[model samples]
Target chain A: MRTYLDCYPCFLNQALRAARIATDDEAKIKRVLDEVGMMLKEIPLDSTPPESGRLIYRKISEITENIDPYRKIKKESTEKALSLYPYLKSRVVASNDRLLMAIRIAIAGNVIDFGANWGFDWDTEVADTLEKEFALFDYDKFREKLDTAQKIVYLGDNAGECVFDKILIEEMKKPVVYVVRGAPIINDATRADAVQAGIDKVATIVSSGTDAPGTILDTCSTEFKALFHNSDFIISKGQGNYEALSHTSASRLIFFLLKVKCRVLARNIGVEEGGIVIQAGRDR
Target chain B: MRTYLDCYPCFLNQALRAARIATDDEAKIKRVLDEVGMMLKEIPLDSTPPESGRLIYRKISEITENIDPYRKIKKESTEKALSLYPYLKSRVVASNDRLLMAIRIAIAGNVIDFGANWGFDWDTEVADTLEKEFALFDYDKFREKLDTAQKIVYLGDNAGECVFDKILIEEMKKPVVYVVRGAPIINDATRADAVQAGIDKVATIVSSGTDAPGTILDTCSTEFKALFHNSDFIISKGQGNYEALSHTSASRLIFFLLKVKCRVLARNIGVEEGGIVIQAGRDR
Candidate 1:
């Protein structure tokens, strides 16, 4: 997504904060500030409220100054995710159909997002509305199928969300395989993070290899294909997974996620803004 | 600026590359490689060629992902500054004199700093450097003192460079007061930078306000007699300016810039690992 003008100041703030934390020499600090100012001028800004952008900028600044800005935020975000388990479990149990139950479980497993990402709390009012809407379905037949399946594969998004996924897998007590994008940018979870979170111990972690959001099925490794062949259900999270895998003939694939930023996704699922969707593949 | 083992993959390579170019989708690029398998469980072989940290991590990825990361790079890099000049001139002229000679005058009319704060340029590198380096210099005895006095300022640095100082200023061509840190940091030019650069337009740019590198000089305003009394040299650049003036200073300041990673800077400045610095003052 193009950066809004609102984001420009935030970038400056981040750079300034980094300078504060990184240096003590006055001349050096001056030099860094000069560079930061130039950067701000060079980048174009999207039209946005200065207030919102400023807040984000300040937060980024604080993070740079404090060092490891992502870690603390990730920790807090994960706690929020964990806190939502009760609501998620209650909603899933209250669902009318097995499909709804499966969808809820999959969502509660955690959202794997791609592109135009925003950090949102899973327990917010918007999220609650989404859960309620998706819970009104039946997925019992799918659940029966899943019970006999030997393996399940999950694609993840962002970093903190990965922790929540690990929690979901442990609760389900099903053998799970985790997949992620590889070697592209900071902020996304990595194989090291999985190991750090101990997800590696329970699940086979794999790399998609490509940087594009859409899943290129042909790019799947032999191991990934083998797991897919044996699994009865494949739970894909976020829009990227859907965009990539929607054309597949696998009837067992279920997509669970929130309608955060994409118009195309909202149209495809026939939902309005902030909608929660659970889409199952048609029998081929 | 010794890099930590954990920061090498993303920080040195991915993030640097992103910062150098403009891209359309930074977040998408950020999310593309978030898998467990792609991460280096053991540090990659040290034989991997060393790369420019900023170029590797911040530039390439930002451009490839379609994010315009160079708004600041283009604005503050030395290359961009050189283009500001109408003709070929000295980029970083140095001298001990209070006023630059004829050769300096030819190129001194417009200084294009690679990484100064805001967008102000120098008329002469030598005079500008002297004004900044020796704020207390007895300019009356110098033959070029009268000729050096003008309404231009040069700003430089990246990340924490002071861009906002210019924002607060109502006018550009006045007795501008340029501010610097009264200390030194790694790889930062001294007050000599302003003088040698022949920055005669500035009335005074002092390091009195900031004691440490990147420390925000909240009191830098017309109200503060010591830092901004009859001050025409209201140009500050780099991380030092940002650290000292982004919040408390109300005076109009122009900043120049370039984005250089801290670790790399430390190496260039030949300082101990993780050192911080500021510019120098008469007291020092």
Candidate 2:
């Protein structure tokens, strides 16, 4: 979706949050706010939020000299999710509709996001996800697409969320290329993070060739873009990826699995904020 | 309290809100954001939020050519509060402690703030405020000061809130100079607003001689400053006044009556967000 005015303040808030995590130096943090404030003026509202998000995270990294501010947090998140893996698996195995259960678990794990700035309890989120109704469930469409597709490009979101994605991928029982970010931005999963989550064991892991929190096609490598277009079935995860790819004329190949995190995305998807969705991507 | 880093993003958000209220011209609204974004860079952390707030509203006015963007809204708020005035007085009359009930009513009206961006219902807020415990209740201190004080300076806040302040001023039963903003900023009360709220009928309504949302001493006229210094008992209403005067070495004369609306102010005041306070200001 296109950048809204609401996104401007949200961008600055995210910049400050990332900057704080990156460094303790008050001066550097203030510099981040000052520079980011100045930077916001030049940003056009027509561009996708992730297009500007790419610049914001890069700016935070540059000012703080901390390339991966969320490195420690991401590691802890992965470990925490891994510890819950056996239990998560048991739930999926117990469910009559294993694929649907796994999808809910994956969306639940999405609450781990730092960029969304939601203060969520992990246990509560998992329990709530199991019971909470989806705002937009395109399950029949997802099943229909999966039935005909040969290969699936499953885009990964956060580090911990990857473990939940693993359950869904296992249920898919298809040749899946698990797509991660090219580099660290916020808590977005990189190839190393995906591997840490044991995604390598379940599916082939590859970078989307963009370090941005989302897969901005212009920032992606040619090979990754080729794979993205060639794949008949694609799964876009989280608000960032949804934002980056939502405006694309990608037909109906991509199904977005995410919890609506912000007002802009919620309005765009015709869902309330904090509602979960499995939306089918279509031509603009 | 000094301006926190959190205030930067909040300022932008408020700017956007005020801009939208001011005009439908998308270009002008965008201009407000761009200019406010640039302006934020120049603001000093030591300066009060309303010091910068002055410049932000000015920029909006200049960009949109709407000097009093909230003029119509202020009128409606005043009318709404006026409608509630008889009921408010009845509550005060029925109470065993009339002054205390009036104080609660005054604080309840503070929920009328647009700048705080709290989506509050008037009836619910009024009911809640009557029962909500104060985070910092300096009622004993306030009463003691009121017993001896011959003259008072009551710093008024927003338009609808002025009607509530009128009740409190009437309960004071002493000579009161009801201070208001010299010109409009946000929904903050101006001389005209105070008059419309019948503040002149109860107390002598005077302009603080600053158009800023709050009473910044540097921005205040010499007369207002002199009156402020001379008054033995001062009642500062709402967050903006508290924000502006909180840093001053004003002894113990200034009693700040406000609902803690934002995180930064809440943190500074040692209260939780949404708590009410009758805070006694002291020399730093």
Candidate 3:
């Protein structure tokens, strides 16, 4: 779960990417990238990369003077995903294993994220994740846990991915609390993004009350923390949640549905970069 | 020739690769990568990436306290090329165009550099460069020049590559002054490395004075510079020499015989990365 040396350059790259997305101001981008260089030594090698990621993005946002710089991009991303909803739904419904199909669809949608991936091929990713064998699939265990679970807390990742999460939640048919960020942090889905994605139509939408880009439990509100602790099971989506929560509260039956994007996170999950994973609980 | 933003991560990656090759010490590798991170901002975006590259490798040498860390590896690399010499020479002899064949062989040999590349497969590269279409081939112009030229000043790149260069020199049938480094810097061919590769038997051997890992004319000895100036034609090999000399003295009948490697150099040559190039001159 600790950050690797390789993550250092990536930190800068992510900052550069965020700056590019935030504005077309050449001067602003240069200033942000320069700040990233200045802050390199401050990165904690022992902490998770997402923790470092949050810090970098925070600095980027501070310099740009826009807390939600990805605001328009998030809305545009949600609209893009919504455009795919009907086609994706039909694919899941036609599949023999609807749950499995929906899970892959949701994970595939994780690629819609703006904060991590700069851009991704939509059609190829959808077909591959749905049809191809996963690098880490614990579907049997996940199904077993879901069968007995009373309540599910789904930790959402990005704007566009929230729409995919709704499709998966519909498949689960459980009492679900789809968690969104209380404030904007990178491109992580805020309650606004979730609403834009129509996630409220499928489950009770709640804010995590932290804008750390991931569920850093210490930074979350008491209400969300209590709800998280009370939940019988959790479905965590994307690398941000995986990085932040993989080491802490790992024994609490959190199934990580994510694509291994970065080297450090991939190593932590014991999969190759670009590997599709459906891991059953971090402790398991 | 200026460093692109893309080159920053590559610089760190190169430093890490060198650190990994230098010693198995994990801490040393981490230290070197950290040093590279520190040096990132100091890089002049308005200058060539190799200028930044030299600063990075120089730091690695300082931190590891070992100049020419690739010494043993260079020897082994030369031996690997030497083993293929006879087979390659026969291929050249059997070919319809001996000059063009020799040119490809020499360009293929450029991949043997330890400073620019980590490891390259000799057989595949040699086969492909010989069989495939070059991204840039000014062979017609080069042949016209070579028909009248009496002397060639050959700039050598790496140790193992010098062996391949020898095979090309045999095919050229012209008087050649082989230039190697005065001192060790990466796996670049030094006087000792060139001597070991039997370059002395094939051509007149000399050294550029400085160990900057490139043909910086100002840093080169007066004798070598004079020889370079006096030569009727120049056969410049590898990316290092290309970076240093490509812009300044490009019109002085220099035939760049090298593979396009690295993003910056590839961009400089106006070709795709991994391109096999035999450019007539920078301006041409």
Query: What stretches of model 3 exceed 4 Å from their correct place?
Result: A23-31, A63-73, A113-119, A282-284, B113-120, B250-253, B282-284
**lDDT (10s digit) by residue, model 2, range A92-148:** 999999989999989988888999655678998888878999999889999988988
Candidate RMSDs in Å, in order, are: 17.1, 1.6, 2.7
Task: Decide which is better by lDDT, 2 or 3.
Answer: 2
- Tell me the tens digit of each residue's lDDT in model 3 across B131-216: 77898878898999988988888999888899989988998898888999887777889988898888999999989775776787
User: For residue A35, what is the lDDT in candidate 1?
Assistant: 44
DockQ of each: 0.02, 0.71, 0.37
1 or 2: which has the higher DockQ?
2
Write one digit per residue (lDDT tens) for candidate 1, span A1-284.
Answer: 23332233334434444444444554444444344433343343231222222233334334345333344444455565556556655654565753445454555434433223444445554355434565213345446756786777777655555665665566556778887755322234556555555578678888755343334455556666666666667766655556555555753465444333444445555666555655566544
lDDT measured at residue A101 in model 1 versus the true structure, 0 to 100: 53
State interface RMSD in Å for all models: 13.0, 0.9, 2.2
Weakest ten-residue segment in model 2 chain B by summed lDDT: B244-253
Interface RMSD of 1: 13.0
Off by over 4 Å in 2: none
